[model samples]
Target: MTDATARPVRSSPRPTGTPLRAFGALMLRDTRVLSRELLPFIVRVIMQPLLFLFVFTYLFPRMGGGNGMMMGGGSFATVLLPGLMAVAIMFTGIAAVALPLSTEFGVTREIDDRVMCPLPVYAVALEKICFSALQCIFAALLVLPLAYYIPSTPVLLHVSSWPVFVAVMILASLVSGALGLTIGASVQPRQIGLVFSIVVIPITFLGCVYYPWALLSHVRWLQIVVLANPIVYMSEGLRTALTPGMPHMPVLAVLAGLVGSLAVLGTIGVRNFLRRVIS
Candidate 1:
């Protein structure tokens, strides 16, 4: 009777939903949040590119700057368009991942909720990368049309190869996303502004945003130095894809560099993110 009363207990099995489902759920949630903030996102995405177009492509040309002479006979607008697009994508990726991550890792402690989910810790970092990459793509699309039509100086853009253009855009966005993840995970909340000044400012100006990478050849050492800046490849890749007739970096080199950057930065970012979350 005593033995019968002490019945065996069975532990319940874990939940049945797959990692895919969890990832999808998290993505969907992020999409919904993005949708709600669509207006601000659009404004943020558009503002910098708009200023660049207005000042460099429009006002400067009208103010006696030669329309195309600055960039080796290619229309300044044409040269600038791709660089501006790269800037938009880069900024989108950084803002999409970094700011929220800072807050989550800061006093809000919201990251706990995310890590507590059924998904693996690395999946959370991956979700950030994917989400930011998508945002970067969308930003690129928006900037492309605006860049083509909005400039008062007629911009001549010819896609030499659609495949190359697509490849550059996708690869650049991924690199940007990975960079954002690494920066987000590594920077403390209080040092965010300093990091931007020290890291982001130099990247933007030295990124070949206002000029072509090939133009650096006149200053031999600069050409070699700028090669280390990932954005140079992105800008050059876009220049190659969009204006193949103009001087640009070799396509194979750009592609190879981007792939390498993605691997290294993505690995470091995920490891740092895991450390931050687990600690």
Candidate 2:
């Protein structure tokens, strides 16, 4: 037999762009799975933020003592609604996605199933980010009806700066997702509670969610510390975009800060996730 006839020919390499296709496939598959798991995810994302808005905005003024920020003849809901939206998005990443990721990696080994997909490991992480970001978006929307309901006065939102508000939400979601990835990969399932107690809760309180950065000017050290928190920038940016009359930081700088931090943290988290997978 002729050698050419006897031996099978090798196929040429597939296109280098195959990784992107593979990446897209992974994202689609995970999104499908995520949709099926939506109910509890929705509940978890909405619960805390709703509770806070109900108790603080609705109950506080009813009981008497909340300043004008409560909607009843107050601007309380207007100033705080955007920040609460951000907080809900942030918690979707930290509590809903991150803690579960710790369990998938440790107890159930579910991350193994994800890593087994025919794509770069980074693509798997990207899918996770996309899923978590969707939850963040959902959480943001869920807060809307509550925003109108809680304040005794009318809730007024100036949505003229939608362009910058969109930028802020995207940047905040990316940062929160990266942070979830990093913390998930680093901690064991047993230690996730500690992470929530130490890292997540502190970040939330200091993130400038309840008030504008200008309001924190009195505590110079606290202001300096919050400058390092991505949430502060996100909350302040959202306020600037959605409320022109409110005091806030520069929208451009805050957006830049959030995007920059997301890039840095996301790069590190993806690298670490890859290492964990390969190990």
Candidate 3:
């Protein structure tokens, strides 16, 4: 016979929380998990952008790779700064949302725990998007310092309008999160790797990240084609806000693209998420 004192203590069950509380709790859970993996998170966020800046800004310029490698003979670092930040934000959203969501939805079934929360299913998807946006914002902040100092040339940043800068950052981050959500909900776990190859690669290369979009006037047809890429707006938008000296798309067009993409991607992501959860 076991002694009463030796037996494990049972905790009382708590009621399912209200929707706002549930949402906050879910966000908190993600925060705790990320905190535990802080090292890996930092590495994942910094490695690519850091290496890219080092090679292109520091090494290539020093190695007799002339201003031809630069953007219109201005400092490459200035052009690269906004672009790298955009890439950082985009990468963070996909990594934070898509990879984990696919695994949880497919193999681990860990999503069930979150789904069983008292909140609505669409709320769940929104939480994922919101959380990923937070991460994207944070990832961009992390890249900012690295982009500033690591380059051989000076990185010039002049925020023409504070409100525009703030608006673009928030809107662009939401678009990225929504895109990640759509991919996570729609793609099968086994085929997720294909997303990086087909979708991610093409978008990054064509995103106007390495150069100004206005320069693409020489390739007018290609310019029209790349406008379809959401990331083109992101890179150009950041260039508008941070590097006003750089050639970028109009503020109106950038805002329009981001808002439209957010609406489209967010709707599809929520619908797909609900279907996946119910099925």
- The top-ranked prediction according to lDDT is 3
Q: Which ten residues in a row have the lowest lDDT in candidate 2?
A: 65-74
Where is model 2 more than 4 Å wrong at Cα? 1-8, 12-17, 65-74
Please, what are the lDDT tens digits per residue for candidate 2 over residues 23-57? 77866776787789889777877787778778777
Full ranking by lDDT? 3, 1, 2
- What candidate 1 gets wrong by more than 4 Å, as runs, is 1-17, 65-69
TM-score for all predictions? 0.93, 0.90, 0.91
lDDT for each residue of candidate 1 in 166-261, tens digit (9 for 90 to 100): 999889999899999988899997887888899988988998888888788789898898778888888889989987877888999999988988
lDDT of 2 at 185: 76
lDDT of 2: 0.78
Model 3 pairs in collision: none
TM-score winner between candidates 1 and 3: 1
Error of 3 at 43 (Å): 0.8
Candidate 3, 1-279: lDDT as tens digits:
778789688887766668889999999999999999989999999998999999998898889756425575468888988888889989899888899988889866888888898888899999999999988888888988897788887788889999998888898899899999999999998888999999998999899999999999999999999988889989999999998887889999999999998999999989998888888
Evaluation by lDDT, superior candidate among 1 and 2: 1
* Steric overlap count per candidate: 0, 7, 0
Clashing pairs in 2: 68-74, 69-76, 71-151, 71-152, 71-153, 72-152, 72-153
